[model samples]
Target: MRKFIVAFFMLAVLVSLVSCEQKESQVVDRKAEMKTSIDSLESVLKAAEGDLDEDLGLQMIDAYVGYAKEFEADTASVIYWYKAGEIAQNIPGKELYAVTYFANIFEDHPNHALAPQSVFLSGVAFDKMGDKERAAVSFEHFLEAYPSHDWAPDAQAMLQMSTDTTDLDTQVKAWLENANKTQE
Candidate 1:
């Protein structure tokens, strides 16, 4: 009975060690894979910079977002999130992706250096998508949390502009009415 107990304990310890090793290996593998993908996409982007291939830009954004999400605790993750958000801004169809990636930096790692910029850019992304309400909310959040930031003025202006579209709306309405008058 004593010998059996000793063998069982040894087996358990060995299994635990092996499990930890496997977990570490998996982490390294995942990081390496993301790095490869990001590098490949960036290389393609550099080669086609002037023409601006929106599709490749989106792929690069996805790679950066994937890396950040998969390794949230790593410092590099926040940087990748910023990169993803910035790239998404230029891609016409990826405004929402930009907003989420930008929000993730501040929402998940508020103490990081990119947090303030991320919040500001989140508002910009929302604005670009024509989501005035959301853009105003994001700007408000930035002002509340980062009142002393250099971009505070910009955020405040954006908040006001988003909330008050009366002039533009009135002009559009008047234009439509005039068109109807002309048609009649």
Candidate 2:
């Protein structure tokens, strides 16, 4: 009985140690992946800024978008998108362009690796553009739609803190009335 108890305890400790090691390995792998993504994103962003040809610009954007999709959940996603957005701002006639691009990642790829965070950054771009109302709406939508997401708390805080000067009451009332009628 004593030997059996010792064996069981050893097994349990081994399992616990393995679990912790696996978690640490996962964190290290994620960090390495994020570093690679950042390096790739920085090059593309730099090229996009220096090259004026439409095709080159589009290609750079596409490359950045692809990497952004892959590393969207990685710690490097925010920084990558911010740099991409900065480059995009130089493109003329591209009003709220970054918001639209990032929003599409959330809209079209809701189950994607970076969807929740893409939505959060989408709200951020809107807010940066001085469209606080839409930013709040986007953040609220992120919270309601992705309540279980890793970024939900951040979305909720953003919504609670957002101050919209626009008369959102009218739109909210209209939406509620339509929703109620649909239920009936």
Candidate 3:
């Protein structure tokens, strides 16, 4: 019984090592495959002249999102996530995907170089989608977290605009007061 237990433990250890190796190999293989597909899509986009191709663009977004999600430990994942968010933001009706991808970078990789910009862009994406409340929240979070970032001013502006929603009203009030001042 003791011998059998020892042999089983040894086999289990070997299997665990083999599985880890296989998992690492799988990640590398998948990354290579994804890189090839992204390169192809980029070439197609570059050749598209002035017109944007939605289908090809979505494919590239999917590839980038897949790579980023599957390999979040990889630093390239943050960059690809940002790229995916940018592409999704430009594609009508995919704004939510843009917010998610951008959020992924800031939330999952907060210390990464792109995190601040990604968070700010997430706010922009939400604003573009007309979800002003969520956009304000995102912007506020970005500003609070990255007060010294270069994009902080942009984020602050967006946060104010999104939170206030009364620029036109205020402008009209000023214009009406200015016109009435002529009567006085």
Candidate 4:
């Protein structure tokens, strides 16, 4: 009876170990699946490089943003989020998504080379969306963070324009022209 009881306990222990291993395997499978999805999305983005149809680009951006949100700590997440923000800013009715994605980049990877650009673009996205208050805030944040960046003058102009009450399109055009001049 003692030997039988010991055998039963040993079997239970083995089963528990097997179950734990299976759970670990399941986690690994999930991570692999996520990586595959991210890679596939990146490939799609790459394939669309020259064509860049707005609808398809928006779809890709949405997919990338979804994956970025799911894998926030991954390097791919930062790249995907930045790409999504760039695409979002150009698409009509998607400026807020651009703002969100750019803000995410700035918040998650503040030391990255793209962080200042993200902040500036977030302001542009807000301005494009007609949210002057938020646009001003984002522009101010960018200037405070990168006072001497090449984009600083543009950010300052945007901050001033945000409170100008002028036609947004006209202001944006003037700012772009001024920015181009500065770059020249």
Residue-wise lDDT of candidate 3 within 124-150, one digit each (tens)? 989999889999999989878989998
Minimal lDDT window, size 10, model 2? 86-95
lDDT of 1 by residue, 1-184 (tens): 9999999999999999999999999999989989998888887777776455777777788788888878878888889989988988878978898888888889888878899999888888898999999999999999999999999999999998899868888968888999999999
Q: Where does model 1 exceed 4 Å of error?
A: 166-184
Q: State the RMSD for candidate 2.
A: 14.6
| Full candidate order by TM-score, most accurate first | 1, 3, 4, 2
Worst 10 residues of 4 by lDDT: 36-45
Candidate with best TM-score: 1
Which residue runs does candidate 4 get wrong by more than 4 Å? 1-17, 166-184
Question: Which lDDT values do the candidates have, in the order given?
Answer: 0.88, 0.68, 0.87, 0.85
| 3 versus 4: better lDDT goes to | 3
TM for candidate 2 is 0.44
Off by more than 4 A, model 3: 1-27, 49-51, 167-184
**TM-score for each of the candidates:** 0.80, 0.44, 0.76, 0.69
User: How much lDDT does candidate 4 score?
Assistant: 0.85
Give the higher-TM-score candidate: 2 or 3.
Answer: 3
- Residue 25 in model 1: shift from native, Å? 1.8
Task: Assess the local accuracy of residue 69 in candidate 1 as a C-alpha lDDT between 0 and 100.
Answer: 77
Best first by lDDT, ranked:
1, 3, 4, 2
Name the lDDT value of residue 106 in candidate 1: 93
Q: What's model 4's lDDT at 54?
A: 80
